[model samples]
Every structure is written in C-alpha cells, then in structure tokens.
Target: MDVIVIETPQLGDRSYLVHDGAVALVIDPQRDTDRVDAAAREAGVVITHVAETHLHNDYVTGGYDLARAHGAKYLVNAADPVKFDREPVTDGQVIQIGNFSVTVVATPGHTHTHLSYIASDGTTEAVFSGGSLLFGSVGRTDLVAASDTVGLTHDQYASARRLVHEAEHDAELFPTHGFGSFCSSGPATGAGSSTMGEQLTANHALTDADEEHFVRDLIANLTAYPSYYAHMAPANAQGPGPANLQVPESLDAAELTRRLADGEWVVDLRNRVAFSSNHLQGAVSFEYGNGSNFTTYLGWVLPWSDKLTLVGEHADVEDAIRDLSRIGIDSPDAAIGTEPHAVAPDAPVASYPRVGWEGLLEGRAADDVLLDTRRTDEYAASHLLGAVNVPLHEILSRTDEIPAGKVWVHCGSGYRAGVAASLLQRTGRDVVHVDANFDEAATAGVSMAELTV
Candidate 1:
C-alpha cells in the first residue's frame, strides 16, 4: 500500500492518503483539499473514501467537501451529531478499497466517538490513529469539556494501549496530532511516524502508569489551548463549507477607516517590529510572522462574526488567509496592500518601545508590570521574578488585571511578547516589548524563579 502523509505544519496535524493502486482513502483532511486532490490525481487513483477520526477541535476538516467533490463515501462515527450526510461506520467494520482492507477501530478519548483506521494491503499495514495514539504521547482529553476531562483521559489511555496491543507490531502508526501540536496531552518524544512496536515501548500513555495515574498526569499537563478550539466542534458538526482561497479585494483608505470606525476588525499582518514601528491607528497588530499561533490568537481575540480585513503584502495576506481557513476563518472581507502611510496619511501611527532582556531588567521599576505571555506550563516551569502570568490567549479578558503603568512583555522567544506589547499598546497602556530570547534572562544576570507547585 502507498501511504501519503500530508502535514499541516502550522497546526501540527497530519492527513493520510492510503491507496492500493486503483482507489484511495483520505483520513482526517484539513480545510484545504486541493493538495489531497492533487496527490490523488498524481497517483492515478480515484479518491473513493473519506474518513474522519473525530469531530476536529483544532481546524476545519475537508472530508465533507473532498468527498462531495469526488463522489466518495464520507465515513464518520455514528455517535457524532454531525449534520451532513455520511456513512456512519462502527467498530470492526472493514472497508475494502481495491486491494486494501481498512478496519475501523473505535478509539474514544480524543473525542468520545473517535476512530482509528487500520489499513493493510496484504504486504504492509499502517494505522491512522488520528488524535488517539500519537508519536510518543496521546491526544489531550480536555478539549471537549472540563467535566469530561477525567473520564476522557481514562478512555485515552485505554485507547492508546488497545491500539498498541491490537495493531501489528511493525504496523506504521500515523497520528493527526503530535509534532508541536497543543492538542497533545504531552510533548511527543520523537518526530514523524513511529511503528506500533516503538509506540508500545515509548508512548507515555501506553507505558507510563496505571489509568488513574495517567489521567491525573494528563489533566495536570494539559496547558491552555487556543480559544479558537471552542468554535471548531460546532463548525465541524455542521460541516464547514469549502475554503475560499481567492485573494480579497484591496480596501481603499476611506473604506478601511469606515470599517474601523464601525468597530470592525482590521488585523495588521506585518512583523511585530514593522507593525509596532508605524501602523494605522486602531488596527490590531496580530503579527502574521510571529509564529504558527497567529490564527490561534486572532481567532481568540476577534469575534468570528466581525467583518475582518487583513493588512499586509500580497504573500503575507495570502498565507494568513490559508492559515486562518484551517480554523474556519475562510475569507476576510478585504485585504489592504497599500502602504500604511499612504492609506492613512493624517492618522496617527502607534509604536511601542522594545528592549533586550538586560535592558528590561535594568530599566524596570516598582510600578512597571512584567507580563509573561507564554503558556501556563511554560510559566510554571520557569519565569522572571515578579512577572505576572497572563498568557497571550488570556490577555484580552484579563486586560483589567494589568496595572496602570508600563507593561514589560516577554515570552519564550520574542514573538508572543511582540504580539502582547502591541495588544497592550492598543489599550493605551505604555508598553515595552522585551524582544529578546527569554533564555537570555538567566545569562543576562536577571532574577528568575521556577514554580514549585
């Protein structure tokens, strides 16, 4: 069997194209389906089946659209309350695709109705575990709801162990979430695909401890996930439409001002430095180049119903739109490519002061608040002395907690810090972005503290 792995690097999810010469099956596809289609065409095989492991909570699935386009059977769990038409397959159901046989294994925990597909073409075998059994860790069980976390954690452990025990020892294991994905309960020890044997030996969920201990550790380790995740389940349930990849029209200066005046979101997609150096008044700086978490923050802070406009170069705007679509932000109302100065000539441009780690330590005062925008676990592991932890995801709601005075913002690298600084500046708070390696704090002779509890 030819197994093609398609990865969405930004979200750290993988989709699989498994085929046996004549026909193929796509598992857990992302919003953009063109790449999968292209792969199928190149392989000279028709996409006969599309299967979803679960109702995704991180990004929109392209399974519905891809299946409709190819006239393929869209397979989903019968337990999922999805609105669209699909073939609801249950546990032990075997689907024959040309010379390949795919057996659906019910694996809950990632989602209550999650399924892992085992495909074999007589010679070789592979399992598309989706979010169930990852490279070295299991999928996080907390995304569903707080009440379900403990129960789901138990299910997750059982599911991981079951996959390892049931699947052939040498069978290739391909999971949807792992490689730096926040969807994982913990960090994967290795990268890319791993054999069932390797996972049985290395995966923490499979080998770490008993169910109770695994659940406890899993719950404790699940850091804050993206706020965008809240909308994904509902959107996926209703079957999100195909993404509109077309570049939006460029909004003139007057139109941009009108939108901003109406309280519409105008996200600036430039680098943090450029965005902070000079940007149109009222434009929120959500630096596109910051990191893969660009869409996560945007989806979290901005209302989904708001008429959104993106300001950046052609390339950046296009890339942002694609990334945004993964989280169901399909199309922006407009994209502005005109120079900011020309677009809003008379408007006052806003900028924030940037400082190195040493500079922040030396210049910080009693009233200055140090805001750490990293993940809660990252903050718990180690952080600067007296730095208040308000992760970038929680910044919007906790702005009231920020004391009056300059806010010195810093994250692991400098990306999140830059984004936080712009957000603070937008709120009229005097902010200093510590645009330096946070690891340099100790080396720079700054006081650092590690949380004991």
Candidate 2:
C-alpha cells in the first residue's frame, strides 16, 4: 500500500491518499483539490472513495466536491446532520479498495460524529485518527459548546484508549490536528507519524489518568480558536463549492477609492515590514508570511458580507486567495498588484512607529499603553503588569475600549504585534509596534503578573 500525506501547514491539517495500485481513498481533504488530484495521477490510480472523519470546525472540507468531480463515493459519519448526499458509514463498516480495506471506527470527541479509519493491506496497517489519538495530545473537546466540554473530554479519553486497544499494536497513527494547530488540546510530544505502541506510552489521553483529571486538563489548555470557526461547521454540513483559483480583476485607483469609501475590506497582503512602512490609509495588514496565519486573522476580522479587495503582488494575491478559500471564502471581489504609488498616487499613506523591546522599556512613560495581543490564557499565565489583554483577533472590534495615547503592542513574538499595530494605526490611534520577544519583559525590569483562576 502507498500512503501520501498532504499537509496544509497554515490550517495544521493533513489529508491522506492511500492506494493499492488500482484504487485509492482520500481522507480529510482540504478545499484545495489540485494537490490531491496530482497525487492520484502520479500514483497511476483512480480515486474511488473520499471520506471525512467529522464535520470539520476549522476549515471547509473538499471531500464532497472532489468525490463528485471524480465520480467517487463520498463517505461521512451516518449520525452527522449533513444536507448533502453521502454514503453514511457506521462503526466496523469496511470498504474494499483494490487490494486494501478501510474499516471505520467510531471515535467521537472532537465532534459527536467523529470516526477514525483504519486502512490495511494483507501485511502492514495504518490508522487515520482524525483529531483523535494525536501524537502526544488529543483534539480540543470544547469547540462544540461550553456545556459539552466535560462530556466531550470524557468521550475523548475513551476514544483515544480505544484506538490504542483495538488497533494493531504497531499500527502507524496519522492524526489531522497537531503541529501548532489551535484545534489541539496541547502540544504534541513528538514529531511525525507515531505508532499505537508509542502513543499508549506517551500520549496524554492514553496514559493512566482518571476521567476527571483528563477533562480538567483538556479544558484548561484550550487556547483561543479562530472566530471564523463559527462559519465552518454549517458550511461543511451544507457542502461548500469546489475550489476556485481564479484571481479577481485588478482595481485602479478610482475603483479602489470607491470600494474603500463604501466600507469594503481592503487587505494588504505584503510582508508586515512593507505594510508598516507605507500602505493605503484604510488598508489593514494580513501579511503573507510563513509565520502569519493568514486565513485565521482575515476570517476572524472580515465580516461575512463585506466585499474584500486584496492588495499585493500577483503570486502573493493568488496564494492568499487559495488559503482563504480553505475556510469557505471562495473569492474576493477584486485584487490589485500594481505598485502602491501607481495604484493610489494621490491617496494618503500612513505608517506606525516600530520600536524594539529595549526602546519600549527605555522610553516607557506613565501615559503610554502596553497592549498584549496574545490569547487570554497566555496573558493570564504571565504578562507585563500594566498590559491590557486584547487578542489580535478581537482588536478590530474593541478599538473603542483602547485608551487614547501611544499604544505599544506585543505578542508572544513580533508577528501579531505588527498586525495589531497596523489595525490600531488604521483606526486613527497613535500606536507603537513593540516588535520583540515577550519573554524579555521580565529581564527588562518590567513588572509582571500571573493571574490565578
């Protein structure tokens, strides 16, 4: 059997293509199908099945569209309340593809309808434990609802133990959530694919722990997930459209001005440094960088109904659109790659002052504001004494709450602080970007506080 892992680093999710010469199966695919198709073509096999472990809460699944396009059977949990037609699967149900077999194992925790698929040839075996039985930790159980947290945590423990007990002793485990994903309950202990044997000894949920302790730890560790998560479940339930790679038309200065005046979203997709140096007055920064979670921030801040205009290079704009489409944002109204001067020669340009951590400490004054753009839990763990906790995702909505003056923004690292500074500056607030390591706050003699829950 040949197994190919397709990773979407930004979403921290993986899709697998498993085949045995003639037929293949795709598990937990993202909205972009080009890679999957390419993989299938390279393998010289026809895709006969596409399966989703659950209704994804993080990004839109391309399973349905891929299945329809390839005329393959689309599989989902039988219990999920999906609006589209699918081959509903139950526990222990096995589907034969060429010389391989995929058996469904009901593992509900990440969601009520979650399933883990075990694929095996006559010899070796592997399990695609989507969101269950992760490398070291398990999937976050609180995404469904606050009240269901405890119950889901209990289910998570049971499900993880089941994978360890029922699957083959040496079954290679591949999970969809981990590697810096917000959907993970905690950080994974190891890297790459792990076996059930390794997990039974190392995975937190698989270790000998009581249900209460596991639930408590799971709930306590969940950081702030993206606000765009609210739109994913419903959209996935109804089945989102196929991926659209078409770039929007380039808007000239006149058209861009009209959109800005009409309150449309003007997102600058350049690097934070370029965006900070000079950008259109109203455009906000959603930098296209390796460290930037482009979709998460853009989806969190942009209203569902607002028309978006991407401003960046052609390649960058296309890449941004492709990433945005993963979360069910198929296309923007317009995109422009022209030089800033040529596109908006007469328009006003704005910038925010970027300062290092040392500068912030040396120039500290009583009247200045220090903003912490990390998650609430991170802020509570350890933060500068006087820093106000306003996560970068919520900065656009909480502009009125910020005190008037020079706001100094910093996150765990500098990436988020740059994004926050741009938003603050765009809103006409005097802002200073504290682009430095937050760990140095204590060394700089800044007062620190740790909140106890």
Candidate 3:
C-alpha cells in the first residue's frame, strides 16, 4: 500500500490517500473534493472509502461529498453530532479497504469525538492523527469552549499518551495540524517528516511526565484564534455542499465603488508594498500575492455575514476565491485588475507611508503612538518600548482602546501590521505600515522591552 499526502498549506492541514494500487481511502479531505478526485485518478485508484477524524473546527470537510461522488463508504465517528449519513465507526473497530487494514482509535481532545486511524499493510504502518498528536505539539484544546478547555486539555494529554502506547514507535506520523494551523497548541518542531518515535522524544505531550504541568503551560500559552473559527464546526455538522469555486459575477468600476461605499469587504490582493503605495480608498489590504495566509487573516477579521469582493490580477482573484471556499466563504464577487484605481475608476484612491524601524526612529515624534500588532504572548516576549499592544486578532474588538495618534503599527514580519494598519486606515486614522522585519529592528538598536507579567 502507498500513502499519498494531500497538503492544504493554505489551511496548514494534510489529508491522506491510502491505496493498494487499485483502491484507495481518503482521510479528512478539505471542502474542495476536486483535488482528492484528481489525486485518486492520478494514482489510478478507485476511492473505496473516505473518513473524517472529527467535525473540523478549521476548514469544512469534503469527506461526505467525496464519498457520495465515488460511491465510497464514508466513515465518521458514531459519537459525532453530525446530520449526514456515513459508515459510523467506533473505537477499536477495524475496516478493510483493498490491501490496507484500518483500525480506529478513540483520541478525543481536538474535539470529544475525534478518532485517529492506524492503517497497516503487512510490513508498514501509518497513523492518521488528525489534529490529535501533531509533530511536537498536540491540537489546541480550546476550540470546543472556554468551559471545556481544562477537561479537553486533560483529554488531549491522555489521547497523546494512548497513541504512543498503542501505535508502534516506528509508525510514520502524519498529523493534520501543527504546521502553522491555529489548531496547534504551540510551536511544532518544524521537521518535514517524523515518526511516532521522534514525537515520543520531542513532543511535549510525551516528554512532560507531569500531566498537570503540561496542561498549565498549554493553557497559559494559548493565544487568540481566528474569529471565523466559530462558524466552521456548525457548518461541518450540518454538512455543507460542495465548494462553490465558480467565479462570482464580475462588477464594473461603478458597481465595485458602490459595494465599497455600502460597507462590503472590498479586499485588495496586491502585495502590502503595492497596497501601501496606492489602493482603492475603502478597499482592505489582504494581498493575495503568495498569500498562504489569505484565507486565515481575511476570514478572521471580516464580519462573517459581510459580502466580500476581491480586487486583484485575474489569477490572484481566482486563487483567493478558492482559498476562501476552503474556509466556507464562497462565491465572493470579483473585480479583476492590478491597479486599484484602474479596477474601480470612480473609487477614491488612498495611500499610506510604509517604512523600516530606522525610518520610524528618525521621524517618530513623542506624540506618535507605536502600535505593536503582534499577539499578547509576542508582546510579552519582546516589543518596541512604549508601543501599544492590540494583537492582530483582537484589533477588531479592541479598536477603541488604541489612543488617537499617528499609528505606526509593526508585527513580527509586518504581515499582521499590514492588515492592522489597513483596518485603522479605513477607520480614518493616520496610519503608517512598518514593512520591516522585527529581527532587523533588534540589530538596528530600536528600543525594546518585555512585559513583566
């Protein structure tokens, strides 16, 4: 049996296709089943089964649709509160597909009903640890609820321990999260490939013998996740239809301007530099140029019910729609063109100055408010002296707290600052995007401090 990995880097998750040359089983597919179907075809295997480890809190799953399309048996946990029909599998139940034998293991924590599948074909074994035991960290326990966090963290610890004891130490590890997904409890080891043995040595879930210590550190370090996460599980439980990848109706400059005026999320998909140079007066900067984070940030900050319009090069606009669809934001309207003014002729033009830490040092007056848009933990670690900290994720809710001044916002790598600056700029604040890497700011002798708490 050969295991093919289908990585959704945009969402920092991976789905697996295990096949015995003729038949295959797909695990935890994203909303776009086309990619899974293409993989099966490319491998010359018929999809005999599709399984979901849990009702995902991240991307909407394509498992149900993919199963229906291929006439494959869909496997979901019997305990999941899902409305869709599937071959409900329970812990310890074994299923056969072509040359592979899959044994389901109850590993709850990512969610209460989560399951990890161990697939073996004679000599080789592979564990499909969907958001459970990731590379060096486990999936975050907070997605369920604030009240459930403690219980779930304990469950997560136990689950990781169970996997290490049950699965072979040499079993190849393939987790669906921890590669930059917010679902991760913390930073992963960043290794490309790992085995259960490696996780046993390096994963905190395994190395920390004291479960209480593990839980405390994990909970305290838990940072703010995307606001859009609230809508995903419900959508998955109801079983969303196939993703709508079809391009939305193209709007002329006048219609686009009207949409912007009406307070729709008209996102600009140029680089932050280009967007800082000039943009549609009301358009939000969400640059789609290599925007692996396009869906994450855009989905996080935009009001969930707001109609979205993408403005960029034709290809970039199309790609942004595809990324948005994975997160269940479907069929957003499009305005294709490179230049903001060119795309929407009647739209007012806007520009903001972007600079490095040195430029900030030279020009910043005593009255200028330096805004640190990194996370709270990041601010605690090290930040510009006297900079106001409103983490990028909390920027929407805490906007009123930031003092009125010339806001010079900066983040670890300037991405979050770019997004924050645009939101502030849209609110009629005098803003400057600090487009420099924070690592450089240190060597450049910028004043920095760490929060005492």
Candidate 4:
C-alpha cells in the first residue's frame, strides 16, 4: 500500500491519497480536485472512493466533485446524514478497495459529525483521523454549541484515549490538519506525520492529566477562529461543492485599480506582518489559507459583483491564486498594471508630540494629556508621569472616553500607535502616531516611561 499526503499551505490542511495496486481512496480533498486526479492517474490507480472525515468548517470540501468526476463512491457518516450524495459511513462499517480495508470510528467533539477511519492492508497500519486528534492539540470543541462542550470535550478526550489504546503501536497517523492549520496548534514548523505512539507520549493534551485540566488547557490556547467559519458547516452539508482551480493569468496594476474602483474586492495575499506595514489603501489583507476564514466576512462586507484582484508578494501569483481557489473562489483576474511604484518613496516617518524633563516642566507650564494604549498590566508595570489609559481595541467602542482637546497616543513600537492614529483620524479626532525613536527624545533628557491601557 502507498500513502501520499498533500499539505495545503496557509491553511495547514492536508489531503491524503492511499492506494494499493490500481485502486485508490482519497481523504478530505480540498476545493481543487485536479491535482488529486492527476496524481491518481500518474500512478495508474483509479480513484474508487472519496471520504470526508466530517463536514468541514475550514476550507471547502471536494468530496462531491472528486466522486462525480471519478465515478467514485463518496463515504460519510449516517449520523450527520449530511445532504450530500454519499454512501453512509457508520461505526464499524468497513469498505474494501484493492487490498486495503478501512473501518469507520465515530469520534465526535470538535463538531457533531466527526469521524476517524482506521486503514490497514493486513500489513502496514494507519488511521485517517480527520480532525479528531492533531499532533499536539485536539480539534477545537467550540466549532459549535454541540451538547455541553465541557462534557463533549470529556467524551472527546475519552474517545481519543481509546484511539491511543487501540490503534497498533506502530501505526502511522495521517491527519487532515498540520501545525499551522487551525485544527491543531502544534508548531507549524515541524514534520507532518507522527507515529501514534509518539503522540501518546509527547502530545500535551493526551498526556496523563485529569479531565478538568485537559479541558481548561484545550480552551485556553484557541485563538479567535476565522470570522467566516459560521457558514461553512451548512454550506458543506448542502454541497455547494468544489471547483477546478486553474492557474490565473496576471493582471496589470491599471486593471487592478479599475476593478477596485468598479467595486471589485481587492484581496491582498501577503503575510500579516507585511500586510499590516504597507498595502494598497483599500485592499483587504488576507494571507491565503487564513483569508478563507475571512471570506464570508469579505462577502458580507463587500458586494457580490466585486471581482477579486490579487496582490501577491515576491511574484507569488500562482500560490496566491491556488490558496484563494481552495475556498471556492476560482480563477480570479490579476492586476492589469505594472508593479506598484513607491507611493511614498520617502514616506514620511510617523511622528507625534514628544515630552521631556524640560517638557515635563513645560507640561506643568502648559497642561498636556499623555495617552497610552498598552494593556492594563503593562500600564501597571510602568507608565508615563501623567498618562491616561485607553486600550486600543476598545478605543473605537468608547471614543467618547478619549479626551477631546489634546491627546498623544503611544504604544511599544509605534505600530499600535499607527493603528490608533488611523482609528482616531476616522473619528475626526486630532491624533498623531509616535515614532519608536522615543530614545532620542529621552536622550535629550526627555522624561519617558511606559504606559498601559
């Protein structure tokens, strides 16, 4: 038996194709099924089955298309009875293809209809545990309000422990998610596969721990999930289905600008840090896989007629388009202009009002309001002599709280200050983002201290 794992970057998703002789089975395919088809054909294998571990909330699923295109049988759980066309996959139910037999195990928790499939060829052993047990963390239990999460998590933990206890000690575990994938929090920089024994020994969540500690730890590390996942479950059940992700042709800048001006959504496919620093004024920054989380957000925020224009870094056009296509977006047009010239060649360095010891006397001479946007704990650690706190996220929520007449906003390295400055500017408040070069001001005997919000 041969097993191949395809890792979709940005989203940290993995798809697998396992075959024996000339028959193959695909597991948790992404939106684009051409690649899977190509691989199967190259290996002289006919794809006979497509299995979805569960209705996914991350990227779009390709089960329907893969099955239809290859005339393969689609397998899914009867418990969920998702509206998609699939031969129901139930607990202990086994399917044979070539020499391999896969047995279904109902593992619920992350979502109500999750599954874990154990596959063996009577020689090598493995389990395509969809979202159940990732390398370090279990799938997020909060994907939905399924039963009592606390109880569900407990049940999940117990079920996972069963996998650990039952699967062959040397069975290679192949999951549909990797490190960067939201499905797990394991370091995204490591190897993709691990033996079940390794997870049993090293996985923090699976270690010997009481149920309460495990549940608490599970909830603590989860970041705010992508804002768009709320709609994926229903869409997957209804089978909006997948599309062929063809490579997109590049567009010139003028075409890009035209599209945007014509109300097309411009999705900036760049890293978060790069995107945060500089980008086209109205372009929405969503790095590939991560962008899908915000796709629904973009759909609602922007009109449907808005065509998507891609802005990629380092000439990563194809990579950007491929990532976008995974979320049901297909064949977007590229910008129809030259590379963007330096807008602010010598963009003015951000600046703001400064204070000094002489300035302190000057402040005493003329009362000046010192503003800070660090966390409250940071503020308690240290603060400017007379600065007031206004945490950044809440700034817009409580605009009335920021003093009207005069306020100087400063954060660690001026990044937060710039964000705050933009927010304040929108609200018609006079504010300047401070440069991080406060040391120069302090060197000139300026009185500087930390401030928290």
Candidate 5:
C-alpha cells in the first residue's frame, strides 16, 4: 500500500491518497480538483472512494465534486446534515475497497461529527486522523460555537485518546492539519510526519493524563482564526463547483479607476515595500508571497459583498487568482502591470514610508500613536508602551478607535503592518509602517508595556 500526501502549504493542510496500485481513497481534499485528479492519474489508480472527516471550516472541500466526477462513493459522516447526497458511513463501520479495509472511528472535537479512519493493506496500517490527532496536538475546539468551547475541548481530549487506542501500535499517523494550520489546538511539532509510537510520547493530549489540564491549556493557547473561516463550511455544505482558475477579465486604467471610485476591492499584489513606495489610491496592499497567506488575509479583511480586482504582474495576478479560488473568491477582475502609476493613470498615487523599529527608537514624536496591529492575546503577552492594540482583522471596523495623531503601525511581523499601513494610508492617515520583526523591538531598546509570557 502506498499513501501519497498532497501538501497545500498556503493553508497549512494536507490531503491524502491511499492506493494499493489499482484503486484509491482520497481524504480532505481542497477545492481544487485538478491537483487531486493529477495525483490519482500519476499513481496509475482510479479513485474508487472519497471521504471527508468533517465539513471543513477552513478551505472549501473538493470531495463532493471530485467524487461526482469519478463516480466514486462520497463517504461523509452519517450525522452531518449536508445538502448533497453521499454514502453515509457511521462510527465503527468498515469499508472494504479493492484490497484494504477502512475502519471509521468516532473522534469528535474538530467538529461534532468528525471521524478518523484506520486503513490497513495486509501489512502496514495508516491512520487518517483528520484534525483529531495532529503531529503533537489536536484540532482546535472553539470553532463549533462560543458556548460549546468548554464542552468541546473535553471532547477533543477524549477523541485524541480514542484514536490512539483504536489504531495499530506502529500505525503511521497522517493528519489533515498542524503543519502550520490554525486548526491545531496547541503548538504542533511541525514535523512532516509521525507514527503512533512517536506521538504517544510527544503529543500533549496523549502524554498528559489529566484531561482537565489538557482542556484548559488547549483553550488558553487557542488564538484567532481567519474571518473567512465563517464562510468555508457553508460553502462546503452546498457542494460548490470546481475552482475557477481561469484568468479574469483584464481591466484598463479607466475602468480600474472607475471600479476604485465605486468602492470595489482593488488588491495591489506587489512586494509590501514596493506597494508602499507607490500604488493606486484606494488600492489595498495584500502583497502575494510564496505560501501565499494570500487567501487567509485577503479573505479575512475584505467583504464578501464587494467585487474583487487584482493588480500586479501577469504571473503574480494568475497565481493570486488561483490562491483566492480555494477560499471561494473566484475569477476576480484583474489588471496586469508592473508600474502602478501607469496601470491606473487617472487614479491618485499614494505612498507610505516603511521603517524599522530602530526608526521609532531613534525619533518618535510625542504626538505619534504607536498602533500595534496584533491579536489581543498577542498584545497582552508583550507589547510596546503606549501602543494601541487594534488587530488587523478589526482594522476596517475599528478605525474610529484610532487616536488622532501621526500613526506608526507594527505587528508581530511586518506583513500585517504593511496591510494596516495601506488601509490607513487609504483613509488619509499620516501612517509610517514599522516593517520589522517584533523580536527586534526589545533589543532596539523600545519600552514594553508588559513582558509576561
């Protein structure tokens, strides 16, 4: 038996294709079916089955559509009230494919209906613990509901224990999240892969016998996830069509200017520094990078109601559209150009100065407001003195909370600072982006409000 792992680094998730040289089963695929289809063809196998551990809260799942295309049995949890038709598999159900058999184990706490599957091909057994049992942790328990957090956390603890007990002694573990995914309840080890034996000693849920301690620590460590996550499961439930990776209609300078005036979203996909140096007025800088946290941030800050447009070099624009598609933002209008001024000729040009923490240490005016654009927990742990904490996700809604002064924006990393800088710049604020790592601030002699770990 060969289990091929498909990594989607941008979202910090993985999908698996398990085959015995002829028929295959896919688990937790992303919205892009092409990647899954390609993996199957290359493996020289036909996709006989597809299973979703749960309706995902991050990216749209390709399972429903992928199953339909291949005429495969779409195995979703029997309890989930999904809109689409599928082969409903319940807990302890064994599915015999071409050769191997898959045993479903009820492992709730990623979601109420979450399940983990153990597959064995006569000799080697592999456990597909989607979001339940991660590399060194488990999936976050807060996603279900605000009130369900405490209850679900306890459930998460039980789920992890159940997975280990049910699976084989030396079964190789494959989790859908926790490479860098926010779905990880605690700090994952960031290892590529692990076995049940390694995780038995290393994992928090397994090592620590006290369930209450595990629940408290897991909930306390759980941070904010993307606002876009709210839309994913709903989109996934409806069983959406395949990703629209086609290049969008190219917008000229005049049309682009008109779109900006209409208050449509016009994303500037350049280097954050290059974007801050110069960009079209009202264009938001969401600089596309490798691993392109492109969807995570863009999907968070922007409204679903707005018409989205992309402005960048041809390749970057193409890549950005594909990145956005997995998150359900498809076929955005785009303008391909290296020169921002030329792309939107009629639009006013805007620029903001980006400096390091040293710049603030060297010369910070008395009237300047130091804006810390990190999550609340991050700010509370440690932050600069007199820094007003307004998270990046809350920037649009909480603009009025910002004090009247020259603003110096900073985050744990400069990427968010650059994002805040552009939004603040568009609002006509005299903003200076402190594009430096937060670790440099203390060493650079910046006064801290608190240093409690």
Candidate 6:
C-alpha cells in the first residue's frame, strides 16, 4: 500500500491518500481537493473511497467533494449518518479495495459518532485516529452542546479506552490535531507522530490520568473552538463545492499600519498571550492559529474589509501565509487608497502608541479602563499598578466580567494588550494600548495613579 499524509498546517489538519493497485482512498480531506485529484491522475489510479473519521469542529472537512468528483463512495461513521450520499462504516468493519484493506473502529471519545480507520497493507497496520487521541493529549469533548456532545457519557469514554486496547501496540497513529493547533492546550511543539505504546506510556493525559480526569483536563484546557464551525462543518460535510471560493487580500506591514492609523483593523493571527504583549495600538486580534479553517472563521466573524494584515509568529509566517492562500486571501503590495505608514529609523519600542508609560497614563486619563490582560501567574509577579487583571484568552467568554467603559489594554509588554484592544474593538468598544510598562511611565515622570479612569 502507498500511503501519503497531506499536512494542512493552516487548520492543524491532516488527510491521507492510501492506495493499493489502482484504487485509492482519501481520508478526512480539507477544503482543497485539487492535490488529491492530481495525485490520483499521476498515479493512474481511481479514487474509490472518500472517508471522514468524524464531522470536525476545528475546520471544514472535504470528504464529500472527493467522493462526488470521482464517482467514489463517501465513507463516514455508521452511527452519525449524513443526509447526503455516503456509505456507513461500522465498528469492526473492513473496507477492501483490491489488495488494500482498512478496518473501521468506533472511537467515540472525541465525538459520539467518531471512528478511527485502521489501514492494513496485508501485514503492517497504521491507524488514522482522527481527533480521538493526539500525541500528548486527547480531543476536547466540550465542543458540542447536548445531543452531539461525545466522550461525556461513561460508555463513550470506555469505548475510547477499548479502542486504545484493540490497536496493536506498534500501530502508527495519526491524529487530526496536535501541539500548536487550537485542538490542544499545551504549547504546540515536539508533538509529532507516536505509536500506541509510546502514547500509552508517554502521553501526559493518558498516563497517570484516569478516563474522567482526561475528559476534564481536555475540557478545561480547550480555549475556544472557532465560532465559524457552526456553519463551516455542514458546508464541508456536504462538500465545499469548488476551488473558486474567493478570499480577501492581506496587506503588508506598512499598508497594515497605515490602515490601523486610518481606523481600519489589523487582525493579528498570533497566539493569544503573544498578541496581548505587543501589537499595533489600534489593531484587533482574532488569534486564529496557522490553518485554513481560519479562513472561514475570518469570513464569518469579521465584516468585509478592503485591507487587513496578518501578524503571526516569526517561525509560523510561511505556514500562515500558505494557509491564507488556501482561502484566496492574497497578500497585496499595499493598502488601497492609502499610503504605507513607516516608523522612524531610530524609533524606540515606546514610540508606538500602545508601548510605553507615557501613552499608558494618557490612555488612562482618557477615561479608558486599564486592563492587564495576562496570565494569573504573570499578573501576580509584577504588573502596572491600578490595572485590572483580565487575561486575553479569557476575554471573549468572560466579556461580562469586564467593566463597561472606554478601555486601555496592556500586558507584561504590549503584545497581549494589542490582542485585548483588537477583541474589544471588534465588540464595538473603544480602546487604547500603552507602549510599555508602568516603569517606563514612571521614568518619564508620568503619574499613572493621577490619570484615573
């Protein structure tokens, strides 16, 4: 069997093309199906089967289109059947295509109707375990509400535990999401593939944690599933239809800065904590990880804009750039109808409106609420006095906890404060950010206490 894993880093998603003889199977495909079609053509193989482990919450799934285009049978979990044309895959069932065979095992922890496809090339076995289990953690159970929620029932979790036991100790496991992906809470790193044996022993959530504990930890750590999933999932399940989907253009740094100065949004796609610390003063933050599904999220949540800039982790810029391309969001040379804004050659970090103590005091005097959006531990160690604690990650769901008024957002530095400002601004709240810490204000002889909100 020839197995190729297609990594869609934008959505932190993975799809596989497995073939034997002249038959091929594509599992959990993302929105873009051009590559799969091309691969099949190059190999002179017919795509006979298109499989989806489950209806995803994090990104759109492309199983339906692959099936429709090639006259292949669409495969999904037998339990949660889609209305569209698809063949139901049952637990302990095996799909045979010439010499290739894949076993469908019901692994219901991540979602009630989820399944894990175990591919066997006559001898060796590899399991595409979807969101059931990941490298260091498991899929979150709280993404669904009542009827669709999975892994909460005792029977459901036990079934997951059983799936782990059923797989061979040496079977290669491929998960839907790992580190750095919005699916897991731990800092996304070193979260490569691992064997069932490795995960059973080294997986933090699996080892030294009970099934209930695992479920609780998964729920507790999940930041927030994308709000776009409510619609994107159905669209994907039915198939995204075509590749002609249009996405907006992205602005370069200078153009983005100019738009920000002109009262346009500069949505940063970095992590929550990093976004809070230092960002452009008037920027808004969505913090969608480097993935294609974020495209739909951006479309669903944000109003159509002529200009936008994507700020990502320095290391993630390329992947982030690629993901944005999947949805047709092109990077433009400049913002339309505006000149690029350039910072001075010798400008200090404190020179930005969101960076230093001087701006912090002025922002406070503007009757803006001083918000310290950092982790509780980070807030405890040291922070600007009189700044209320409101971590950026919790700002969305905990919006009511924040006092209503003009807001001044800040963090240990200025990144997270930018995120807070962006989120707050998106919700129609006026906000400003300081350039630096309180010490910078004190050094500049600014009275932070006197500038009361």
Ordering by lDDT:
5, 3, 2, 1, 4, 6
Summarize candidate 1's per-residue lDDT along 221-267 as a digit string, tens digits.
Answer: 78877777988988889987899888878877778877666656778
Q: Score every model by TM-score.
A: 0.96, 0.96, 0.97, 0.71, 0.97, 0.68
Give the clashing pairs for model 2: none
Candidate 1 residue pairs that clash: none
List, residue by residue over 325-435, the lDDT tens digit for candidate 6: 444344522222111122211211111234466555544664457788877655565655567887766776777777778777777655556556767765667666653
- lDDT by residue for model 2 over 1-453, one digit each (tens)? 989999898888889999998899999999999999999999899999999988999999999999999999999998999999999999999998889999999998998889999998979889999988899989989899999988988999999988777789898998988866777886586487789998888888978577788788778778888888888999999988898888877887888877766656788888777777788888888888676888877887667667788898888888888998998887785556645676777677788777777788788689899999998988887999889989988887888888888899999878889888888887778888888888887887777876667
Question: What are the root-mean-square deviations of the candidates from the true structure over C-alphas?
Answer: 1.7, 1.6, 1.3, 7.0, 1.3, 7.8
Better of 2 and 4 by lDDT: 2
lDDT of each: 0.84, 0.85, 0.89, 0.66, 0.89, 0.62
Evaluate model 1: give its lDDT: 0.84
Model 5 lDDT, full chain set: 0.89
Model 3 residue runs over 4 Å out of place are 450-453
TM match of model 5 to true structure: 0.97
* Model 5: residues with Cα > 4 Å off, grouped in runs: 451-453
lDDT of 4 by residue, 1-453 (tens): 889887676576889999996899999998778889888888899999999998887777878888988899988788774776678888878889889999888888676778888889999888888888777657777777645677667766876787777689799988786546655642322566788888887766578488788777676555545544665677678775566454566665556556545545666555434544555554554444433333433333333344677666435556656665565556676652212343222212122343333543454323545667665655666656667787654565667887665566666545445455545544456554453533354554556565444
